[model samples]
Target: MRVLGVDPGLTRCGVGVVEGVAGRPLTMIGVGVVRTPADAELGHRLVAIERGIEEWLDEHRPEYVAVERVFSQHNVRTVMGTAQASAVAMLCAARRGIPVALHTPSEVKAAVTGSGRADKAQVGAMVTRLLRLAEPPRPADAADALALAICHIWRAPAQNRLQQAVAQHASALKGRTR
Candidate 1:
């Protein structure tokens, strides 16, 4: 599967494309960051992000989009910006009719580094090793975006199965009620 992972931030939104299936070698199709000036007006900043995401969606045409789920932070301003950026990513994918998945930071960290508490350096190192790249992707956010894609590629199979089972159970329950 081809996935575009988005690490959303107002200052630097990371974008990466990864292609692979579970239990197979993964390939990094592309990786980069979308930057918007902090001094820009809020509307302008959001528009920049929207354009950046749209360009990625068009260029990569990914089957799925994995976005980092926004989490609460002590810095309310930072969290708000991240959540806004994340919403733009989801909106872009939705407009293209591509499926979107939200992965938490800890979930991505554990998937790539075998520890939820893994540091950014550890995650970057793992991403380099996993993709067989000569060096880690720069700016940290880019690596994080790739990690989100890798986590989804590796975990989606099991997650799908579980969803299917739950749906079947619900169907059976509805039949009994009828």
Candidate 2:
């Protein structure tokens, strides 16, 4: 499967594409960061992000997009920006009819480094080793984006099955009620 991972931020949103499946070697198709000036108006920043994500969608044509789920932080301003950026990513994928998945930072960390509390360096090292890259992607955010893709590539199958089971159980329950 080809997966695009997005690490959304106001100043620098990381985007990465990886192709692989569970229990198989993954290939890094692309990786980069989109930068928007902090001084730019809110609307302008969002526009920039939208354009960047659209370009990526058109260029790589990922089957799925894994975005970092926004989490509460003491800095409400920062969180708001991140949430906005994440929305743009989801919208871009939705417009293209591609599936989107949101994974928490801790979930991503655990998937890549075996520990939810793993440090940035550890995650980077693991990402490098997993992708067999010569070096870890820079600016932490880039590596994070790649990690999100890798996590989804490894986890999505079981997650899909669980969702299917839940839906089937719900359907059976509804039929019995009827």
Candidate 3:
């Protein structure tokens, strides 16, 4: 599966594409940060992010988009911006009918590094190793985005099985009732 992972931020939204299935090495199709002027108006920043995400969608055409779920932070303003940027990413994927998955930072960290509390450097080092890159992607955000993609690629199979089992159970219940 091809996944586009988004690490949303007003100043620097990270985007990356990874393609492969579980138990196999994945390939990085692209990785970069979408920068919007920190001093720009909120609306303009969001628009810029929209355009950048749209471009990624057009180019990579991922089957799924894995975005970091916004969590509460000490700074309300920072959290608000992150939530806004995250919403933009979900909107972009939904508009294209591509499924969007929201993964918490801890969940992604654990999937990639086997530790939920792994630091940025640890996560970066793992991403570099997983992708077999000579070095970690620049700007911690970029590596984080790639890590998100790798996490999704590895986790999706089990998630799909769980979802199917739930659906089958519901269908069996409906048949019994009818």
What lDDT would candidate 3 get against the real structure? 0.95
| lDDT (tens digit, per residue) of candidate 1 on 63-132 | 9999998978646869999999999999989988999999999999999999999999999999999999
For candidate 3, write residues 61-113 as lDDT tens digits. Answer: 99999999998864677999999999999999999999999999999999999
Reference-based lDDT, each prediction = 0.95, 0.95, 0.95
lDDT of 2 by residue, 50-154 (tens): 999999999999999999999877468699899999999999999889999999989999999999999999999999999999999998999999999999998
Which candidate, 1 or 3, would have the higher lDDT against the true structure?
1
lDDT at 116, model 2 = 93
Cα misplacement distance, residue 129 of candidate 2 (Å): 0.5
**Least accurate 10 contiguous residues by lDDT in model 3:** 69-78
Candidate 1 RMSD computed on C-alpha atoms after optimal superposition onto the true structure: 1.1
Please list the residue runs of candidate 1 whose C-alpha ends up more than 4 Å from where it truly belongs after superposition: none
For residue 101, model 1's alpha carbon misses the true position, in angstroms, by 0.5
Worst 10 residues of 2 by lDDT: 69-78
